[model samples]
Target: MNQKLLMAIYFYPRGGSSQVVRYLYQRLEKKWSSALYSGSLGNKGLLTNAETFYRPLNVKSLDYTTAHTAWQKGTNPFDTENPMQASLEDRINVPDTLMARLSPEQLAKQIQSWRHLFSKELLEPALAHLHHLTPMHNAVYELWKKTKIITHLHGTELKMIEYIRSNPKLPFGDWWIEKMIENANMSNLIITVSPHDRDLALELLSVPKHKVITIPNGVDIEIFKPTTLPDKVKMSYWKHWLVTDPQGWKPNHNPGTIRYTENDLKEFYNDDGSCAPILLFVGRFTTFKRINVLLDAYSIFKSHSKQNAPLIIWGGFPGEWEGEHPYEFARKRSIDGVFFSGWRGHDDLPLGLTSSNIFVAPSVREPFGQTYLEAMACALPVIATSTGGPASFINTEPGKKTGWLVNPDDPYSLANALQEAVEDQNLRETAGQNARDYIERMYSWDNIAEQFTSTYQYVLSHK
Candidate 1:
């Protein structure tokens, strides 16, 4: 048998791309033998992935020793044997006088700032810059000079933009593009998760088009399978009941509750024992996510339709961001159909997906949306914006296609799609089934992993 495909994924821990990185890790670990050789600011990426997936065996956090001078005196937080520690010690050699020149507090502050700055998102560009700026730090010039190890750049581009956006006068702006090119050359293979990103990487970084591969992100099909939901869930039906309440059901849902269990669900149903359809919005609660526009569209949709408004299962609760709550905004506007579900993880996400008639992704700038893929895999139809990464997958063929694509920023477009999806149950079910079939053929984790494995083999053989 061929040797195991030993690969290292260079990633940023808490950034937007971690979801995709974790998905890649989950898929690859199922088949080929793999380990996460992580470098981060505060080992944040490793910790974040750990919390999200919470799997520890495959992970190897490698914080650089020279990343902090204290490490030379033995106070580094990372494992001593980490690859980064070796590179750090070997590269950053301050003169004895120079080291003793600074006060302890000044030295500590400098190291602390450096430690905080190395996010996974920025690691690629920083590594790429270091490769050109100080050739001794280049992994390609050192470790890969003889070893047959394969290195892949996963979520670097997003961070480069962040660095550039935040620091215009960032060092090496003159050679930044060239350094990025060198880093791209260092990778045995580059697997970009979206078509738009693939194009952007090749164009901006000067990576050869043929060297980059675009693999649309995938979902865990087995885990996200549709469940047999009850015909009458005995939940409240206020918003959606106004339109299609043939059962003459009264509203039974209470918006103020910590958890809604089966007994509570039954008791919450109307006197006639029937409930209305629920709409769902799941993802991070942030401004770029466009939750405000969704509320506005929901208000408009409810006002126009004579049917009772649908109950919304909005996940992604906001932390103390000081921004006004979008649900509260909808409520103030007399939009009474939203039931916020806070944030649910892997196991509960599928059940939540199946519980809704439609999944709406209205992000104004979504880099890559794993939630859309998850929703589709759960046999739930989607109404996503026509821009961003989700645009690549949410094809708009109306009745036969997987789901509807709309202008995420436009209230009318979202309203139109929402109305279309809710008007006909057959349309919703058909799109939902098609979505499930599409996910199985294209976006299942097993298939994605196999594709990656093949890419690894090809890159190792050819490079």
Candidate 2:
């Protein structure tokens, strides 16, 4: 019989950690009897509802929809029956208020909610794999102290801590950071996505070197791999996503608040009437993502870009933003070629990557860029920065690279890279194929699942 295992995370299906849990559970389900405990944000039928996102898995969720709704109605989300979990970033207009901003009472509620989340499924599993260093970990320790736990840091927690270190007096950040360290110290093992992150975890969590492991995320190649859609089909998808069903939102507004006109589709073509090279960017509107810098670079590229070459910015979780909104930034600068796809489903991401000619997201120090790998799998040559997770993987070598690498946060460097990429179809096609090849050899989910199998085996055997 398969040994029982429990995996948990504090967030619902809103971010990378959620997908990591789902993908791992999908693969590990073959060898381990597993159940998921996640903090959820909506009713039963919605994607934020953990049961729905992790459907068919034995699931137990702490619904935050009521709490989130309360926040929407101008009440404190944290004071509701199920308080919204705090986030790594202190986002405005979102239920995930910054962790540092949480008051002492709110912090206790965060831990208690999570402590109670596993009230039933403290299912006596042989091992428990918990994602992040959230208050959830504190709760897990109290409830399942005997069950060996492996803590996985997806990078945001580290970022938040880094911010706290710089601003040590920032509210209750120091207290929370100490708890995160305590959680990390208690775990049997700590997992990070990139070598850089692995090293960072050691410094931030103050854990022994033996306790940390680096495991890059995996991609579902079957869904994300390169495809050649017919011309009409491509046009139909573009029109449908941009004109017919936009999800882009403005400050205080929800999805579909920034829909485009049907005439907007004309921007995808050159004056000569041929399809233009599409530059795609996908990520949330956080400061580190450098969407502002991308707009600056795209403006430089468009100044001389012969083809209309529209840059499609593909995600901005409605009403939630960390800095000058990318939309507002673009407006102030009078940049005309930028488009927003807003936030769409993960299944649609592959389609978006495949639809574009080149992919670029100049995130400074991404923990582990799963989207970059997914873009590579879709055969799109990417443009990444030399600073973070993508640096560890993307090769910009003359003959071997999957994509181009520009200096982080430098608009001129990115503009030059974008110009070179958009102008040469031959270069893009070659790099695209190389990207696909690299992902097949290095990032497939099956291959990654095997790594987890070995790691889990090691943890169990030592236990």
Candidate 3:
């Protein structure tokens, strides 16, 4: 008989954590009898359809819960009195907050530690805001019925501020150690994408060393391939002459003409395009993603380089928070030779990767970075931080291994590594090949599926 496995995770699939979960689901479908996926697309970001990944395992329907919307009527899995819906004061679903599940004293002590943040001024407003964002109980309850719940933790840096406020004098205050610990303790199968995460989990969360599973993120190697178009994808004057009034760029300028297609990239010619190496940075524009650090590193690289100044391609989502993100810097500072393609889906990812010489993932607090693997799958060498998940599996041996792993916060270090990767074509090619080989051997979905299949069997057999 097929083993029943229930997975629970918050957030949409488009996010880093869910993306890993999605990968696992794809790999381990046959071994598990049933699977459950959860979360909302409205505020949780883009989520893939359940049918796309879960239906083959005989999953009935994805149990969805939104913090912004009301939950539909249901039998409830948590078996709580407050079912159909819940106000912020009525329920708290986060596993970390489930410490409220403890004795009143435990809950009180946890709250007392945060009594400062809730002082006469901030507490009421924060509560008001939180209450306003409270999700429905029916949604949470339905999620509890799943056989295996898989939640990928994204936005660790953003989440750190609140964690610090709650437990200030806590050890490793600068890092999200406690949060990692909480997840490591709570998750039946805590799969971290990075080795740093695995290390931090063991150190801070008090989880047994064996409980934490390290499954680095991956790329679809079959798709993304290298290209040899010297003049096809050059930056044109039209891209630089953008009209920015918040209404966005003007449409009459042959918007389609500016859009680069595979055919266009393959055939387009450039008068001055003498093939400057193209370097790419892909992922969200956030403090944790460290777009600013990347820009600074690029600037540093440019200053140091004497010849063949590399062209930089910055892709992915815009910053949701305030302040000037990389895209803003690229647009405002008129940073020449840099192109911003905003965000592109997986369908277009391969083409984009093929167009670049190297990929840089400079995230300050990435929970799991799949972009590096995707770049490698495309046969492009990656330069990433030795933090978060992507760095966990990276085997950087200069020109001998996958990619270069440098310190994230140090822009100078990043610049040095980036400079080397961009300048040496042979090193880039060899590292890229090694990266593809590593992903095929360890990070690919096939191996991940087998590991997950065993994990599911273990969880089911014991439970």
Candidate 4:
């Protein structure tokens, strides 16, 4: 039998990292047998089912709650010592009853205990049979000491550590930082999604430069490619997404609370009844994403521009946001021509991009703006901040520009870019085409998968 590749992550099918794992596994399955181990919140719907989310790939859910009980029962659930015929599902449970009641400190300790047991009982025994072990985050580095390990960073944990360090009053900040550094040091290879993150890992985690590799996130060009949807179909999409199946949540309100009326759709069309220019922003409403800053800039742009452009704020996980709720902020400022499309699955993003005119996200220090690539693939010109990953691709040159990269956190700069993009229809079309061409040539997921496979082979051969 071929040696199996073990992939582990602490999250379910939610973030960009999960998508990366899914895509890589799809491409690599032809080359090697693989199993994915991930955390489960117990929901058995299409969204939560590992088999459904990662179709045709072997998936194992590690219920830490069940593993915790098995630990107390004095029987190693992952033990191959007795050679029993128990299936992985038979040993795992859906609900984490004990974990739900724990305090923050207790929860941390419980996670640590689970990791220790997982490393010792499951990972250690499987090391000999495994050709490579890849974990999406560094928290599991200690688990694969005997195996060739590739540790991937998606930039959140590093940003958390940096924030914690800057604010020393944060509890256990120093200890967490030290633990992250130790994990990075122990890993055989470290891979981050952006060059900015690579530099941060080298500087903050103190990892050697040669040990780290920068692999930017990629998009599904096949899914996100530019195509014109019929007017009726496009309007139906906008209505269904904004009215029939609303997912936008207001601060301290449940999902779908922020619904749209017939009057709201008027702004989406021009005086001549044509589709108005639509500016889209997709991401979590986190502090660093600067959703409020984008709102401020949009308000400024609307005041100065003659065109009727509506800004569509597409995503924020239901009922979860930092600082002021975007809807409340908009209301307080009386900002018109701004619509919140709510949070939807990534599968629907192509429709959103294709139906829109431009993609704008004013996030400073964005780890890697994967949405920008997705939008670019759909031939939508991008407006992004200059500090992080988007800066690497978004060109600001006059005649040969793919998109605009403005100064981070500067509402005036973003507003200026918005004004320029909305006013010049020719510039928008040219930049959109250029954006599509660039992403096709460089950032397609097939190309990214090949790069990942080569890296895996290199690690396996060397180790």
Candidate 5:
């Protein structure tokens, strides 16, 4: 087996890309000796703390904790000794600079910082599995020219490149665009999270088709599998998340800005014995996520349906957003049922999914919906858009349908799907069962790992 060095320039469990790194490594360990070099932030115990999250593994991190502290101290975090890497998406306040916003000098700092990180590590792995396209790409090229590389695109980079290409005059647009292509060409193998993403890699990066391969992110069935939670226990969890120890954030504020009262818990369940069906949406509040659509649909669904259900909006990193905050959007519309759970660790996801009856996210162009699989594994009927990653796998056929795939960006379609899911509990139950079955048969981590193993071998031999 080939020795491997898995590298991602992001903190663990931040998003699906990070989750992919964790799950893939666990699966890869039996076949290869691997070391993880990831970007980390926060103190030792937090999820941003890489050593805590990727424990019991050989892990080294480029600590961004200092940069975070610098930001808190009202200094330029980007000018700190260990600067945070620029993000693909443009975000409001917080540490890291956006790639589009990065000046030539600032861009050089990012590459220099990553190079310093690479030099400090005693990494001698036979191959490097690098995640996302960044200044780290240039850093690697500068340090280890002969190192075998497998460049993994989690879909965000492609989206960023697309946005930059559309508006050609965007700052450093030409430079970054050409840089990504050069970075991609240097790789021996390119792995994408979905086939749709693979196509984008070919067109956007202008890399050869043979160089690009689609390997979808996997679901950890052991953790995400369905288990019916008792109402009292479910209510306790919801109370902790929504009322006590709340993390629900608002625009220009830290988490817990959108806390709920004890009386507000009534929306989670009806007066009758049966629990009020929870409509769950889990992801970052990026522009493409189209969370506004979910809020609109939820409002419409509540307006029509006598049986009310609360829409639990979960999972966005604190103080990071693309547009108007979801809380702000729901607030302006006087949306009553929508509740923000803020961002929680991966362990909370299974419980959240099992407690909710329907998993709804109307993302316009979701790269590959990792949360959808996690929700499916928990046996919840999912309502996703008809475009992008969800469209590729969400089968709505007569006997094999697992979830409802509505037209993207259309609130009414989502509202109708939401209505249908809540009303038809029997069909919902069947779909949930089907969703779990599909994940078990198709998207397990072990299966995805096998694909990576074979792909890795081919690259090694050719190189």
Candidate 6:
């Protein structure tokens, strides 16, 4: 019989972790049977539709909406009230007013309360189903107990709990820390996406090194490769994205709140009617992403550089960002040739990267810069920070430069790198080819799947 692996994650298929899970599930199915246990917020849009995205993989969505509603009405999960209701509010939609007013302590307590109820109502059922599959014989039960349960950590959860633990002033800090530690210890093998995250896991959760595995996220090279679209077709793609499917948003606004005009198209195209050298930034507008720093660098580069290359901002999930908004900073500085494409699904990212000239994201201490790989796979030269996973792959040598790697949080360094990338087309193309070659050899999902298979084999055999 094939080994059964259960992958449990709190959120539905939306973020980087879900993407990693989806790829791994596809690859792992060749050797082992697996199931996905995840919490659904009930949106099920193009982005959140795991059933379609992870097609053929057995996916069990623990609907948070139904569970939360049950908690609110004091209805037990065991009691029959059609407990897994299909239509309900998304659990992520906490009222803005309530969120803004909660103190750190109050917020932590509220989250802990929700997490407790969610575990009982959602997680327990999923785990119970797996348990039911095991035979009750003592030897078989012991062997089943040895079944490797891989808990994948994507840095955010580790950082949040660590922050609370280190800062004693936060309410329920100890409680949250203890809970996190318990969860970490429960896992047979803990997988972290980057070395930075593995280090954080060791420091924050006190997990033994033997139990932890560092596996960098992989890209689907087949999907994120350079496309051979005709110039006219490329122009149509630009029109469809910038004009037809506008996703740019304003501060505290819903997606599609900000849009572009036909005049905006001129900013992205050259006088010869071809797309200009587009510098792309893809990721959330979180503080650590240092989007303001990128803007500052772009502003400086634009002042001195002759190239009218546009910097296209490709992502910022609706109403979710920290520090100054990129649009606000751009407007304040009067930065030109800066376009926001808003939040888009991963399926649309390949075209976005293929159409762009450079991939730039100066995120500090990023767990693993998956976008960098995607951009590289799409044959775009990258500009990344020195402190994160990008450093592991991006070649920044003097002559054989695959991309530019600048100091974290330094606007001038990033500006110089951006200027260099914009000025030299030969360097961009040469480095882009190198980037594509490197991804094909090292970071493709096929290779990454093999790595996971090896890790899983080791974990299972030892257990």
Best by lDDT: 2
**Candidate 3, which segments miss by more than 4 Å at Cα?**
42-187, 225-274, 306-319, 331-334, 396-399
lDDT of each: 0.54, 0.85, 0.50, 0.72, 0.84, 0.70
Alpha carbon lDDT at 235, candidate 6: 66
What is the TM-score of candidate 3?
0.66
Alpha carbon lDDT at 300, candidate 5:
90
Clashing pairs in 4: none
Q: Mind giving the per-residue lDDT tens digits that candidate 4 earns over 1-463? A: 2355666666546566677777666776676656566654334555545555666667765443344345447654333221111111111222222111223454344345435535533324221211111222333444455566677788876776667666776455576567568767777788888888889889988988888998877888899999987767788898998888888888767779889986788888888998888899998777888999999999999889878998999988665566788889999999998888887877798899999999999888888888899999999999998898788778834566898888989999999999999889999989999999989999998899888778877776775
Q: Write model 5 residue lDDT over 126-192, tens digit each, in one string.
A: 6778899887777878888667888988889999988887887777888888888998999889998
- Worst ten-residue run, lDDT, model 1? 126-135
Off by over 4 Å in 2: 396-398
Top-TM-score structure, candidate number: 2
Worst 10 residues of 6 by lDDT: 128-137
Candidate 3 per-residue C-alpha lDDT over 367-392 given as tens digits, one digit per residue, 9 for 90 to 100:
66777777877778888888767656
lDDT of 6 by residue, 72-178 (tens): 57664322222332111112332221112234444344344324433332212211111100011111223334344566677766656655555667554575566
Clashes of each: 9, 0, 11, 0, 0, 0
lDDT of 5 at 102: 77
Q: Name model 1 segments beyond 4 Å from true.
A: 1-27, 37-52, 62-156, 159-182, 231-273, 309-335, 396-399
Task: Using TM-score as the measure, name the better of candidate 4 and candidate 6.
Answer: 4
RMSD of each: 10.6, 1.7, 10.9, 7.0, 1.8, 6.5
lDDT string, candidate 1, 52-148, tens digits:
3435435544344344445456554232333222111111232111112223343344334333333232222211112111122244234324334
Candidate ranking under TM-score, highest first, comes to: 2, 5, 4, 6, 1, 3
